[model samples]
Target: MNKRKPLDERRAEIVEAGLSVALREGVESVTVRRVAQEAGISLGTVHYCFDDKDAMLRAMGRSIAMRASEPVIAALEAGPDRRALAEATVDALLVGLKEHQEMRLLTFEFAVSGARTPVLREVAQAHLTQSIAMTREYLQRLADVAQVTWASDIDDLARMTALRIDGIELAWMVDQDDAAAREGFAVLARDVFADMRPELPAG
Candidate 1:
């Protein structure tokens, strides 16, 4: 007989299955029954794993936030000058967005759904907070590695960076134009985030 999977692993599988459903159908269609079906598990199993739909959604929110951070983590591995590293980080973000465009679009759908749905607001808010904090950490690490700083307040700058990326990703999702996305990100990295570069050091 097959041994049973642990609760944590089972929960992760259910979460990923739920995301796959969202990626295929719109976020609004992600009912617990639907997710259960997608996961090929019993309704009892799902119920055992999650308190309710809201709990499942909360899991999905965390999953998306974790998915979103991976590109930056990978980009951090490529050590280079501050400018190049910033550009690499931005490019990695765009690449990750492109690679998982469906999931990314679902992220927006979840946000919009949360805004209109009372039960989901906190889940969405938590994801948003986590995303901004992840960006802030990325910015902070870049600054530390490059020995530079943003002229503006780092807190505010992190918020701006997160919003700018959201706007760009949304535009790309609508247009399906990768070229325009790259151009937009290049401008974002070089022009918008130029504040990340400080003034020259005197002799």
Candidate 2:
């Protein structure tokens, strides 16, 4: 009897393969056959793990979002003061972008794909909504802790914050310069939250 690959391992392998294809090429290149070839698995194995390309893309998006969000959420839960929280959030986000370059690229590509593909659009929007909500919650907590009040809408601020971060990631994807991105983010954050400039903890 032939040995069988563990289900979890197989799923992970397929996702990894899909990510590889996405990063090297683009989301447009991440076909089922390509993922199987990248994983050194049969096409049937890939299909067994994922129903279709859209399913694979959705899985990939969720995996990336979860990984990227985990550190940010953890740092927020640590209850840092406002300045520290801002710095930590920026740091975590930048690190995630650097470590998950392929995932970031895939995300951007999927955003474009979402325009033409309803399934892709739904998945992309879902992740984007989750990301925005997570960011909003963190900012609200920070505001409450700092006792800073803003007249602006909190959700709107959060959406803008998320967009700013996404813009920075998009720029870095084109030019991999951590310094530029970090500096840009710092300046932007300060300008956006100019009223609440609490001193950050010593780095």
Candidate 3:
């Protein structure tokens, strides 16, 4: 007799299968049948976990955001100084984008789809809020580690930085020009760090 997986494990397995399909074939192809096939289960199993494709897509979107943020959080945690923090953050993001272009494309797909679907839009917004909060905490940690005071509010700086990185990635995806984008990100990092530097006291 074939052993049955626990409900939570089965759900996670189905989500992983859906993510694989989204990453490889685009989010549009993530159907119950396709996911079930990918996960080596019956179609009813996929339906049992998700009400429909929208539910699966939302789950996949959340999973994608979490996976994408891991490297960024690690980079932020690795900072010993402001310079190191900036380098690590920028380098991790750029490297990840180059290596996981498919994941980035799926993010774009989520954004566009969310614009049309109210429920999915809420999911997308939640992901964005989570990202901003995580980034703010990371920036605060960096400041504490480096013993540097920011010229602006750390919260504002974190939000701006997060949005800027997202914009840069979106633009790079469309242009398919990594060299120019890398240079642009380097310049951006320099400017952001410069803006955060506390004004020196008069000699």
Candidate 4:
């Protein structure tokens, strides 16, 4: 007889199965039954780990947020300069969006769903807050690399940058125009870096 998997590992496997369903057939299809089927587990097994489908969805959303942050963190670590890092980060984000358009759409769907679901709203807000903080840290690193003092408030700059990226993603969700979106992002990113350049101290 096969030994049973550990609880945490089994839960993670279920969550990933749920994510696969959401990404493929949209969030509406992420039923416990479907996830159980996808994972080749029983419904009772799924319920053993999750109290309900909503709980499983929350876990899946958190997992997605964690997985998405990996490349961004890597970009910050390996980037050469402020502008180059920022550009590389944008490119990475767009590439992911293009590759996982369905996932991108599901994220938007979850956000809209969150407007009515307090728990989900909180989760989404927490994710966005962490992402903004990460971006702020990246900007600080950029300033350090350039050996210049950033003139603007990093908090405001980070928030704005986050908003800009959200807008771009929203546009992609609507238009599905990766080529245009990327082209526009390149120009906008250049202008953004120029605008946020470090201020020179007057002699």
Using TM-score as the measure, the top candidate is: 1
Off by over 4 Å in 4: 47-52, 116-156, 187-203
lDDT of 1 by residue, 1-203 (tens): 86789999999999999998888787888888999999999999999999998789878877886786788777766654655676787789788887777777777887898899887787778777877887788888877777777888888888888888889999999998888888887877775446856753433
Which 10-residue span in candidate 2 carries the lowest summed lDDT?
192-201
- Give the CA lDDT, 0 to 100, for residue 102 in model 2: 72
What TM-score does candidate 3 reach?
0.76
Worst 10 residues of 3 by lDDT: 194-203
Clashing pairs in 1: none
List clashing residue pairs in candidate 3.
none
- Encode model 2's per-residue lDDT on 71-158: one tens digit a residue: 6666665444667766876687777788777777777788888878876787678768767886787677666766676556888888
The per-residue C-alpha lDDT of model 3 at residue 102 equals: 80
Q: What clash count does candidate 3 reach?
A: 0
By lDDT rank, best first, the candidates go: 1, 2, 3, 4
- Flag the better candidate by lDDT, 2 or 3: 2
lDDT of each: 0.81, 0.77, 0.76, 0.73
Cα lDDT of model 3 by residue, 1-203, tens digit: 98988988888899889888877887667778899899999988788888887677767766666677677677867655666777887787788788777876787787776788676786566667766776677677666766677888888888998788778888999898888778777877776667655632344
Error of 1 at 12 (Å): 1.2
Each prediction's RMSD over C-alphas, in Å, is 2.7, 4.5, 3.5, 4.1
Per-residue CA lDDT of candidate 4, range 1-203, in tens?
Answer: 96899999999999889888887787768789999999999999999999987778778766765565556556655455666666776687777667666665666678776677675686566556765776677677766655665556889888887677767878988898888778766766665566554643344
TM per candidate comes to 0.85, 0.71, 0.76, 0.71
